[model samples]
Each structure stands twice: as C-alpha cells, then as structure tokens.
Target: MPTPSEPVDEFDATSSTAADPVLPAGYSMRLLDWADLPAVHALENRLFPLDAWPLSFFEEELAQAVPEPDGGTRDYRVITGPVPGSASGTTATGTAVTGTAVTGTAVIDADRDAGAGEAADVVLGYCGLMCVPPLADVQTIAVAPEAEGHGLGTAMLLWMVAEAARRRATDLLLEVRADNPRAQRLYERHGFEHIHTRAGYYPGDASAQGAGGGRVDALIMRRRLVG
Candidate 1:
C-alpha cells in the first residue's frame, strides 16, 4: 500500500493537463478552529505515521493565530468534503464518535448527544502556516486517502498563497521529502522553487518497519509573492 504520509498531488500523471488544479465539486475550505484539533490529530496520525505531531502542538498552533490587525502570526485551515447521508461511519461529529473535550469557539468532550440533527462536516484534509511578518512557513499539509485526487492539496496551497498575500507576507516556504517527487511537482506548479535541502531531516519510520526510524533529506522550496 502506498504510504498515506505524503499528500496526493496527482491522479493520472500521463493524462492530466490542467495548469492549476481545482477541488472536486462540493468540496470547501474553512478556518480550522481549536475544536477541530482532535480530529486533525487523528487524520495526521493516519497520514503521517512517523511524523505525527503531538496534540499539544496543535493547541499551541491554534493559540498562536492572532487577528490580522494584531499582526497575525499564525493561521490554520481545513478542507471538508460532502458525504452521502446514507453513509454510516465515523466523522468529526457523529454517533460513531466517542467522547471529547472543549476547545475555543467549538465544543468537544467525551460522548455527546447523537448530534440531534446537527449539521457536521467531513474533514478531508488540513493545512497550517506560521508567519513572521514578511515571511510565512508552511507548517503542515495532509489529505485523507479517500479524499485524494480531488485537488484538495492544490486548493489548500492556493488558499495559503492568497492568505500570505492577505497577511502582507512577501514570501512563503516549505519542506518536501526528497523521496516525494509527486509533492515536489505539486509545489513547483505553485511557483515554489527549490532553494536548498536539509540532509537527514525527515526521521520517519516509513522507511523502517517499527524500529527507530531513520532519516530522509528534505528539499526546501520558496515562493516569492508579488506586491
């Protein structure tokens, strides 16, 4: 099985011709609030086995996002996809979900009502960034296995580009695993150019079965935004 650790940036390499990718019909992006951290962590662990981030890290990330008027220092966004009403399965907010805890601007805690006709979203993927005035760094990006090939990853990157512009950032940067040419291609398509590489950067067990994971080089890329 292909590792879900990397984002799905391509569906058919040989026949795809669109210069810019677009999300499938019905998909949408929204600000990912603190309430969504638990769901984000679950999906992160699934997509990035060796590189899963701690729950506390996401909490910190959310706490860091300030309003643009306050010189916005961080931002997080999530992509949601529509699901058939008949599909009975787990969701961020569903009976299939167990207990939870409370987070800012959202409710979470262990075992809640059956949602009582509450409208919920199916989290397809998420992305985050950290900004320091003129520059912004791509903190993370991931897509669910079932949600790939629908342009969610591309859509997220494009959204971030606009976000950087909105925040008055001059450039955006990210690191892609050396083994992930698919992701590199996707980044290149978005105007990110190879800046350099960090040797032995990604210490993921994906290359190792269960033992202490080794490391892989990371290609650093940057995109300069036009004023």
Candidate 2:
C-alpha cells in the first residue's frame, strides 16, 4: 500500500559491538523451513501483489541454503508470534502442524510430532539474504501489516547485516522504490547511500498509470562494510 518497494534497514557493520535487535515478548525468530513456504508465499502476494515472487522462487532460494563445496549462499529467517485462541498451528493449506520451541526460538518442520501441545504459531515477518564474498544482496524482506510499528523490520535487518559480515562480504546492496521515503530513510540510517537509479524498474497497473501502465523507478543503495 505504501508503493511497493524492496525495503531495507540500517546497520553499523564497521562496529564490532553493534547491539542485536530485541524482539517484543512472545515472538521468536528462526531459520525458515519448508513448512513456512505456503504462509510466506501468501504473505508475499498480499504485500507485493504486482511483483510477488512465485512459490517456486522461494523453494529455489531455500535450496541454496544447503552447504556446498564453496559454502552456502543463502540465508533466510522467519519471525512467528502466537495466534491467540488457536489450539493448533495450521499451514496455508489448512493442514495442522506442530512445532517445538527451544529457548525462545521455534523450529517448525513439515512432519508433525504427536502430542506437541496446542500452540499455534503464525508467521509475522520474513527476510532473505544472498552472500557471496565481496558482495551481498538483500533478496526480500517483509512484515505483516499488523506487525508493523514494532521492531521486527529493524531486527531482521540487523540479522542480515551480521550474516553478511560473517560471510566476509565487503558491501551490501538493495533496491528500494523511489516513492517510498520511509524505507529509504531506514536504509540511510543504517549506512546505505543511494548510488544509482534504475528508471521505470517497477511495473504499475495500467488503470493507475493510464493505458500504458507507468513504471516506477528503483533507487539502488549500497553500504560498504569494509575498506
């Protein structure tokens, strides 16, 4: 609704003592798994209908999470909060799922563990990063409408920054829509600076743009992690 943009946040990668973001109580973050694909895909379509990536896209990205001879190239995380009054977790397809929580972190796998109790977890936000040595790219990041205003966005961003640094990346890059100043400011606050603009990079609806369907420009921003 705020003019679709590839949103991002700031991080002081140069500082060794940068504080990790603290999530609000009752919410937990963990590595994304196959069971989350349906929910994530639904959220993606809801948040960015015009340019939402297909379910297959997410599958491919997750597949790269596996360790290769050259090390894994993808990292994805999901934040989930309890669903009030729900007896059990359900995937997007309405199938029930059981998860195990360990020290404030929950692991949701595709297979159900009998007698795991009735605690339903809902995906509130998700983020992905691609790190390949000298460069890192933010693939996607989004938070549910109801989860906005909290620190979810910033927390996820900090995770990406830390992961990129761990992979020894020298720079981080992302694209934001030119019309979304809020997202731009967030990135700038974390050390990202606009370097280029891709003209008419985002597609717009024909009804909104009149006949030809005007496109939106994308601002390319980068944060240098090292000299």
Candidate 3:
C-alpha cells in the first residue's frame, strides 16, 4: 500500500485529470479541508437526518486523511458549485470563486476570496474512503438534493473506486440503506454486488413515521478492485 507521501502512478494527488472525472460545467471537486466541515455537517443532517454523523466524526476522519509515521488511511473529497440562482457561478455578492484541488496537507480558506457579504461556494457533494491495503471502505457519500441528477454521485463513486485501487486495495466495501434503491442501483451500475444484509441497520426518522418511517435494513455491497 502506498502511504500519503508515496505517489501512486495511476492517481497523482496534484494532477486534476488523474482519476478525477470531468464534472459538470461550473462545478469542481477538491480535497476536503477543515474549513469545509461546517457546510459538510449541515448537509449531512439534511441528507441523512435519521443517521447523520456528528461534526466530530468528520473532524476525526479528516485528521486521518494525512497519515503520520504510523500510517494514516483515509481519502475525502468535496464538490462545490455556485449557489442556485446565482449568476455564472458567482455568489450572491457577485463574487466568482472556484475551488482548487488541494493535497491532504493543504488548507483551504473558504472565505479567503469572499467579502463579508459574500457567501462561500456551496458544497454540492462529498465522499470519503478508508483504505488499509487489502481492504477499503466507502465511509460516506452524499449529494445535495439540489445537485442530484447531474451525475455528481457517479463522479464521486468513481473517485472512490480509483482511489482504492491506487492504494492497492483488493476490494472496496460500502453499506447502503435497503430502502434507498436509487443509491443501490447506482452502486450496482458501478459493479458493486450485494454481499450481506444487516437488519435494522439504520434508525428511522421519527418525523417521517407517518409516511412509513421505521428502522431500515442495510445492504452491504462490495466491488473488486484487484484480484
């Protein structure tokens, strides 16, 4: 397995085209930075209210993206785009900003380019991977509601697959709610196979109980990256 300091021939951290999908116009993907936590946490609650991860979970994950001498084992990425209804990828304050890809050790100041009145670029999607040589896991992945249907999810999933392969992981694993057939299909289309099922793996949204909300089973899936 290649450490963070080691370069993987197939996926260069600094190369925009290496293992990165061409995103929709006006949208960009980059390494997840500390400054992105607030937006990521908020989006987590909105997207998975029933089992949203706390802010601390994300903080801990980001810390692992940069391995120490003992070894760190994680990769995370975030996709950003203009605020909806904003003009030409500019924020409400009419300031245009683009997210530049950064390495694990890089720091991005989300507000550096914006004036006091300007809003930071919107995080449209985010995904994470945890790799330890032979095995890699898709820690989390989500696309904002407004950003769905534009292939952002597919793009992120591809990044996970490529990153795991580059890290010499033989297989990649992830769990999805059984009720979320849409996501299941996306994984399936990307060559993931259903391998196991965990009963009642996800807590139900009490607020949505009137519409058939209850504990949901989790479908464990895996994709082979190398033999």
Return the TM-score for each candidate structure. 0.71, 0.74, 0.75
Best by lDDT: 3
Candidate 2 backbone clash number = 2
lDDT of 2 by residue, 197-223 (tens): 988887766577876558878888888
In candidate 3, list every pair of residues with a backbone clash: 67-72
How close is each model in CA RMSD to the real structure?
A: 10.4, 9.8, 9.5
Shift of residue 9 alpha carbon in model 2, Å: 10
lDDT of candidate model 1 versus the reference: 0.62
lDDT of model 2 at residue 150? 60
Question: How far out, in Å, is residue 104 in model 1?
Answer: 30
Off by over 4 Å in 3: 1-18, 67-70, 84-120, 207-213
Candidate 1: residue pairs that collide: 99-110, 99-111, 100-109, 100-110, 101-108, 101-109
lDDT string, candidate 1, 125-173, tens digits: 7888777758888888876554555567777776666666656678988
Worst lDDT run of 10 residues, candidate 1, spans 95-104
- The list of candidate 2 runs beyond 4 A from truth reads 1-20, 68-70, 83-120, 211-213
Candidate with the greatest TM-score versus the true structure: 3
